[model samples]
Target: MKHLKTPESLLFYMMLIREFELKIAEMFAYGKLAGTMFHLSVGQEATSVGTIAALEEGDFISSHHRGHGHMIALGADIKLMMAEMFGKRTGYCKGKGGSMHIADIELGNLGANGIVGAGIPIATGAAYAVRYRGGKQVVLCPFGDGAVNEGVFHESLNFAALHKLPIVYVIENNQYAMSTSVTKSTSITDLYKRACAYGISGEFVDGMDVEAVLETTKKAVERARRGEGPTLIESRTYRYYGHSRSDPAPYRTKEEEEEWKQRDPIKQYQRKLIERGIITENDVKKMGEEIQKILDEAVKFADESPYPEPSEIFEDIYA
Candidate 1:
């Protein structure tokens, strides 16, 4: 299928992402959201939208703690996502998964994991299953730079390459793994180069450029779909918000944040639309309002929905 490069679609997706994060931040401040807060992939919409656009409907994906963008890009129900965050019975996981664990199997989203590097093996296993079943399904696993420090990360890659599993490992190198800089985490600066030692293909691409990421991921996805083993892609992106609500990002300077903000994915895509004449400034404004309206409706649905009954807790849990 041809990728969506139109200005309207790009602007629409970027606005949807911005509005979603805004609503979540608002809800958090209002005491409507429950559980621990994590890093918000607020500025990284282009990378998610571009790569997801290149995926087939039946293909699988594993998301990290900041997974709302992944879910939204894959067409997960916004109302259900909001409800899950609100801990309501109408949620995707029926209010148990919360933000980090939100999932929709029908959409081919295996599940989002709270633990770093947890999804790597899960996606590797999914890839093995696809190969075993003789299906064309591909599994995409996304994790942060910090996850590379985990043993499972290496183990999963080794297993995937050894067996030629159909999977794509994406590292969103947002500069910092929590408060620690990438410089401090790995001796090898470029995360993608590690793929060579594992005897697999690896590439580092600009995560801020939607077009570049989409084009690169298209090739990687095709390679995996062709039964060629996995590809490790390190998307150099950044998070606008702190590691979590508790962090003010004291480790990084205001100048660094400003430098990244200048390359805002939403703005970059919006400008592309204007330059291409796919959408007007008025169109951008209208898109923003539409997404805000959608978010408002989702918030209302979550607020009005009933919380999970006390008895339901024991039903979803296993011994």
Candidate 2:
């Protein structure tokens, strides 16, 4: 495999995402943060981090509801993200867009959508713009398996293929769409095959493996940048948490959860690093300490930030 990124850097990015997510969960559980709802991708960090790592700065990305990892991986400011979650004035959307609606245009994050499959078309439109402008930038659209059933998924793919838009549709298949299992929802379990209908390349990856995700995404990105049509990548990953904060996810079995836990991306990557002698136990400890310090500061910054004034509610409102 070509090493686009060093193993150590990849492992660090995965750990950063994991730790940031864990911190969010802890804060939310203790009422230290405020939001309408939060969808945690606790077990799906590899897909977000690895894919974003493969993209260049100007490349755009459209995120889904469970998109904290996506924003973090794309270099979103942690403090501002935390502030946004807290509804502070210093947030990316000035406290208006909460956990699900955060957007950083300068960072090329089109925004995270709450509605299923909504971001697909937005990303497709962005890709069209890129092609129209003759820019080499690619747009990466990440959504859940549940989104595959949406009409926009097919429409976006067909349009993208017909126009050869520079975009990559990343399906973060976590097996469950809200409480509905993939088997119960769709007959065609192999999501990549859906791309064949658009006459574009499609493939699957071990989403639990950051290296595999990164490598696969890198290839799709290259194809998109080369003016080839979009690529659909079905990443078979899982989420340790529920669809939302209030979900208990009783639809799944404990045995299955435990099995997936054994393949935890962070732990697996740690083992790989150690086995390859890329990082020692001491190095891991230091890295954890550094991440913890960053999280601590992020929380502090968010806590001290001011809330948006009621008089400013009309600000940034277009309609």
Model 2: residues >4 Å from true position, as ranges? 1-4
lDDT of 1: 0.86
Task: Report the C-alpha lDDT of model 1 over 1-319, residue by residue, as the tens digit.
Answer: 2234555675577668767877888888888987657457788887788778778878999998988888888877889989998889998999988888888999889999889899999999999999999999888888899999999999999999999898989898898999999999889989999999899999989999888888888899999999888999999999988887678889999999999999988888888878988778998888878887888899999999999889997895675
What does candidate 2 score in Cα RMSD to the true structure? 1.9
TM-score of every prediction relative to native = 0.96, 0.97
| Candidate 2 weakest lDDT stretch, 10 residues | 1-10
Count of backbone clashes, every candidate in sequence = 0, 0
Best by TM-score: 2
In model 1, what are the clashing residue pairs, if there are any? none
- Report the C-alpha displacement of residue 133, candidate 2, in angstroms: 0.5
Highest lDDT against the true fold, candidate: 2
